[model samples]
Target: MSVSSRPDGRRNHPLSRPVDVLERRVRIGIVTVAVLGVPLAGAAAGGAAYEHDRAVAEAQRDQWRRTAAVVVSEVTPGMSRGDLAGDGKAGTAQVRWTAPDGRPATGVAPVPPDADPGDRTHIWVDRQGRVATAPLNDTGVWAGSLAVGVLGAATAAVAGVAAVAGVHCLCEHRRDRAWEREWDAVEPEWSRRPHQGG
Candidate 1:
């Protein structure tokens, strides 16, 4: 990759054109940033998500509790909050339970799909006596953090690929134009010379 100059002190190789040199540098910088920055951004995103989610989980754990509840109505298939509904098997049920304050509370809770009326099932509730889901466990928190990290990294990688492709497209267009300009300069001189068919 040594560059040579013509008699007029201009670069002799087409690749050494000013625009080409700029494009090459831009490509190297983009690749370097993509390789180093994407992982760092993903790790940062993961750490932020973990810390935020962990804090919320801790608060929820402190304010909520698990208690025994007797189902007052048949637990039918219905959407429940959080990941409970994600599994597609849990159902909603009307339940009765005593709060920590010794006050009776009645609410709908998510129960197993097989729960029937009068069945005793465990449920979680918040301090305000509202039916609630359990706080996220440690594994859930880590999984959420990992998902955020992976998404961030994937997005960055895609952007990097797009940038590289755009740069290459521009370089190709410039090279084509340069070839046309060189041909235009040589065609006249070549046309003046006589050619033998033999």
Candidate 2:
């Protein structure tokens, strides 16, 4: 297309349609954020969260210890069902173990359903001798971090696409309204008939 002078004597480039220009600007913003900004931001945020979780896990590991405990009560099937049936079953049993302070401690802990009294099992306990879960390992931390990062990136991308689509719809609506107005103004002159009573 070639550039030509407008009716007001100003030059109008063939590519200078108002709707197209606005749409291009909107697309640029969306692409910049969705394609460029989102992933970087997600990585940073995920890294920070991962670091925090790792530090906590490290601290927990330092503050806790594993010990052998002897079951003092018969283990029975746990109440949980469905896909989470751990070991295909679970049980609560009273157990006895040597605490960090060298004294015997007793607590209720989860055990395999087949565990009998006097059966020995490994258990984690805090410094205060309370039963606790094991600390997250390095692999777990990395997996968690990756999941967060992916979720963040996906959410940002979706938001950006939705925003661009919304802008496009608005632009189309405005363009259509402008066309209707122009047509209303021109239709009378364009459709005028020759006078027959002259």
Candidate 3:
């Protein structure tokens, strides 16, 4: 009687094939994690930048408020002043005016670019009956925008990394499964085939 040649040439246990496939999948997952590391770092950096910009705006707003008080204390009832000018940073505003006491007074405040001229002007009479001018500074809106931009960029970067990693892992898993199934198909033939006597 003739003996059929084993399809696989070597016998392999059915359970071992599946185990090998699972091991390869675990390796793919590890690689995915490594690939995503760079984006995660970018997300952290973006978050930090957002926080720093927010803190700076807040500090600037507080300083603007103090300057406004000085302006209000220097304005006189009949004193004429030109439109306030911002130093282009932290919404700093400078107003020129003459006090009711006939003294020239200059006050700096924080004012938004769109602030109404009337609202930006404050007249306060000191004990000496001298007028003062107070201007308004609006920095909250700009500060908030800075924070939002930074955070949004960070979120997008992190999400992109996760998506790429997920796709890579899925592809690896599919490939590994196909290889395992091909090996399994030939495995049973090896076990069932007859062995020739030596």
What TM-score against the true fold does each predicted structure earn? 0.77, 0.72, 0.29
Order by TM-score, highest first: 1, 2, 3
lDDT of 1 by residue, 80-193 (tens): 783431455688889999988889889888888899899998888888777888678888789899999998888889999999999989998998988888877777679975
Best by TM-score: 1
Candidate 2 segments whose C-alpha is farther than 4 A from its true place? 1-16, 74-92, 101-103, 112-114, 187-198
Misplaced by over 4 Å in model 1 are 1-16, 82-88, 176-198
Per-residue lDDT over 103-150 for candidate 2, one digit per residue giving the tens place of the 0 to 100 score: 999988767677899999877788899887667777767877898888
TM-score of 1: 0.77
lDDT of 1 at 48: 94
Cα lDDT tens digits, model 3, 1-198, are: 444343767444454445454555565665566457545555565556556656765554443332122333222322133222234432334454555556666655444444443444443334443332233234443444555655665666566566656665776687788777776776667888654332
Q: Sort by lDDT, best first.
A: 1, 2, 3
